[model samples]
Target chain A: MRTVTRLYLSNDTSARAAGAGVLADAWSEHPEVQLIRISSRGAFYLEPMVERDSPAGRVAWFNVTAQDLPLILSGTDGTPVRSIPFLAQQTRVTFANFGETEPLALDEYQARGGLSGLETALRIGPDAIIEELQVSQLRGRGGAAFPVWNKWKVAQQARADQKYVVANADEGDAGTYCDRMILEGDPFRLLEGMLICARAIGAGRGYVYCRQEYPGAAKTLRAAIQKADEAELLELDGEPFPIEVVEGAGSYVCGEETALLESLEGKRGVVRARPPYPAQSGLYGSPTIVSNVLTFATIPNILSRGGAWHAALGTERSRGTMALQLGGRVKHPGLVEVPFGLSLHQILEQFGGGMAPGSRFKAVQVGGPLGSLFPASQMDIPVCYDVFAKAGAVLGHGGIVVYDHETDMVDLARHFMAFTADESCGKCTPCRIGSVRGREILERIQAGSGTIEDLALLHDLGDTMKVASLCALGGRAPYPVLTAIEHFPAEFRAKLRT
Target chain B: MREQVKSVLARVRSKPPNILKALLALQERLGHVPTEAVSEIASALGVTTAQVAGVLSYYPDVRLTAPGRHLIRVCMGESCYANGCGRLLRELQDRLRVDVGETAAGGKFTLDTMSCAGNCAVSPTVMIDRDLYGRLLPSQLDTLLERYK
Candidate 1:
């Protein structure tokens, strides 16, 4: 009997964008080759990366095209997947299932330690689950860095007939794709995480408010939810815990927990004033547990492998691994899940493989669009929440976008302001109007028609937006601009009218 | 148009009556939500027309006006911006003879921008309808555009 060959390819959004779909179609045409689709290993630069199971383990072929099918089928040219420096030199907790199995395959998911978290949660119960989370020292991965157990505790304590577990998959941040990666790749993991959260919070129903931009993730999640429901994996105390996938309509502000609840209720994605926080009153005046996709994705691991196990990694305050996305002008732009304390310099140099050839790193904008810009001089700062905070920067959403020497800091500042102005919900004067004024001033400075007074006015505007704005959208909008001006003063000064 | 909107709205069976979902469903089925169908949608979703209009206007996804045959969304996200997506945008504007957020003269393409679609690894990404094209160059715009028409 002749043995058939099995091949693996990434179905990740980035991989597909890099032309995995076309390659998969080409490979499928062959009768001898059995094609299997799995999630990306987050080594994005090498996508359309194909892997074949060898006696030595899974060997990979990088940046494959439809034309490379013959070479891949022959299994003549490839490196062991784990041997790749990008894949080997990192700790993957949340994304461990990535590149291992087909995203929706429940059997494969369970075979590789999938439902053990839910099983643990079921055995231990809600109070113990919260205790495990507290021990884990896990903070919200969605910019805020708030303690995960605190929010779960509030919702678990709150008295409500209809409570909710909402996973904020509205990853609108420009340079971030971790949430999308989780949702698209190992969606069952996210479902398991949400199920555990529901079990902890005493919630009957859950909703994943995924962004409209990620249609693929939403579709994948919906399919995963259906699969889990059929397998009876979403049951809490022998009752069906229904989880629905709700799509966000391109609103950046909706990423905020309160605003997300508002949008989930089918209203405009406007920022809601606090006091009755989502943990207390959310999703139609009911107690809700709103957490980021990464945060929820992390819960399963913390549950399965004791919280102390997770706490063992990382710094004193920020525990466990963070999925850091490296994009823009980097040689090996991809995602790195590491214990939080590695310097930006180390991450950029080691995992990122430094800057792209012929390009020198000017600055890196950590977090997201609202994240602060750090010069090469500040690259030594450790990737800790407190460390980044002390440096007057945000570790928001763990998106690090590097800019080369060709980038104009002044124009980049203006671009951030423009994004804020465009995406602002217009509910507040500071974000809606101040953002526009900030853009105009930056434009004037860029055109060499601005005086020193305009710079001061820009600072004044930023300060007001920081303090008075309703939500993070308005409040944190000035971060990139202010940080750009502070770090690259010469660039801003050069743009001024002579 | 009213019947089409009603049919689309009827499909949305969520308990709380999702206005966003209804609007999205309507847009998905009809290409664009018609003004005439607003009343039907409002009634079906148990919302006032003003409320529906407010939601319709708030989101960038749901459209009030009909888009061109093919929709072209250029990602203006930080990663793409850093990789010279501006040049690609300019080339697209020249080739399509349309500015950002406007439909081309012949209605072949509608040029618009998304903050990000999380495809930053392949910077300077563009989406024509549902098909995503990445690592794009300004010189490649003409050839890419030729596929849709």
Candidate 2:
């Protein structure tokens, strides 16, 4: 008998809720249309999304709105699921089931190669899973694109009995929301991903340090953790892996894994010195696999489909899909799963649907609070980390922020400086003190009080934080300010005595 | 007097108020803690407001108000904002006659902004309680608000 595929009706829960119902209703009662209670995960775009068994793979491609539900139902998607222009363009490694499955459901996950990775990992052994992840080219989707396999291998190699796996869900970048979206869409995937990390890394416990602001994501994660416990998917030496949901009090620095671990242990969320990285000594002096939600989400997908499948999607070094929290002036501002090599223009125009309202796209603040701003002229730059760096920025968290012409680059620069200044943990002199000084320079520039000397001083302050700060939050804090000055030199130079 | 806070806090008798538990307790008691709670919390907890506010604003999840019984969290994050959350918010304000971050006179309706609802393609959507309303308008809110009334 078709299990009715349990559809959760929504507009009550989220777009995902209504989307799932609408998607379920679209399917002919082919012995597989089970409807479940609507979940409260709040991803309204992909409401009523289909389950794991849903052959409606197109759901993974776009955030299907309730209004689009009718078109989605009647819309016969004849294209091969992979070739669907929407999914085809995105690098789906991390967000494989974003639009495809019920986020909160455990059974739905298993139906579509969901837990197959865990099963495979358990069967083939953890070392082999590590090897495959290494070859598959899975890298961290958090701000830093560190290789996942290396982190795991390091954790596995680290001598410890109480190792841990933690998902860095404390995403608080102003123009970003990818981690939140993924959690809202398919939370179990994240839990399962963390579970897999726990298994391979020989972890006894795991934690998800979600930001305090993301109540929905936190709730989704909490429910998913409960679901994981119910299903007994968490394992330790073949036992249930002890993955706990730790709600961060909302420190922007907590997104930095170490700072997250500190907050998780009930301390202030502040940056830490690496080398004794979490891969070595983390989370209460235990070797830990500290990952971003996107990174964790990618694991199950990589495991189910095989690492090579993900590894094949991106450029040689930057493989798999990059989940983009498209923001700013773009028309379709949402999560975009694009191949790593796609140009920003393609992502912005084709995926994002172009500038919003009375606006000529101007500059973008990439990454989060710490990432830099890029001029529209650099829209040609590829989204790959290396390329973005060449263009004077690193694509942090893939937070593509668009500024229409009206947005003052100077103001934006000052705004970014102020944000970082406020968020600076004050742990390091450069970041703690330098960030404040940087804010002053921007203030000086904005007040028409600066000269080239002040501009030089601003650059100097930016450099000091970049090199001297302990964590990426401080290191990259100057990115937006520097990029703003580079692109809109006119704004600062006009105020400068050049 | 603060039953919700008492209930949640009672469970943490022996353990000191960790930031998570404290914030949860605060949110529980006040329905929504104001920005003032951050400062005033020290008096409540025998700590400083800066200490309280630091914890209050750090976590992305804790909000400051009780959304009227019918809470409509409109995604005003960049994606949604660009997708027309501005106009949508304006329309919501027009329909509700109350600006965002505020509850209605009758406590039947509350409108506020969110970072993102994860429903990017459905920009200009509203999440009332847990339910999400896509491509919303001032006119479309009546059905949702009626459920609460």
Calculate DockQ per candidate and list them.
Answer: 0.84, 0.27
Interface RMSD of each: 0.9, 4.6
lDDT top scorer: 1
Residue-level lDDT tens digits of model 1 in A1-498: 756788888888889888898887777767777888899899999987989988889999988887777787777789998799988999988888899989999999999899899999999999999999999999999999999999999999999999999999999999999999999899988899999999999999999999989989999999999999889888898888999888888888899988899899998988888978899999899999999999999988899999999999999999999999999999999999999999999999999999998999899999899999988888899999998888777899999999999998998999999999989999889999999999999999999998888889989999999999998888998999998998888888887887
- A286-355: candidate 2 lDDT, tens digit per residue: 8988888888888877787887787778786788877776665665555677788888888878876688
RMSD of each: 1.3, 6.0
- In candidate 2 chain A, what residue range of length 10 has the lowest lDDT sum? A38-47
- Model 2, residue A334: C-alpha shift (Å): 2.8
Tell me the lDDT of model 2 at A355. Answer: 80
- Evaluated against the true structure, the overall lDDT of model 1 is 0.90
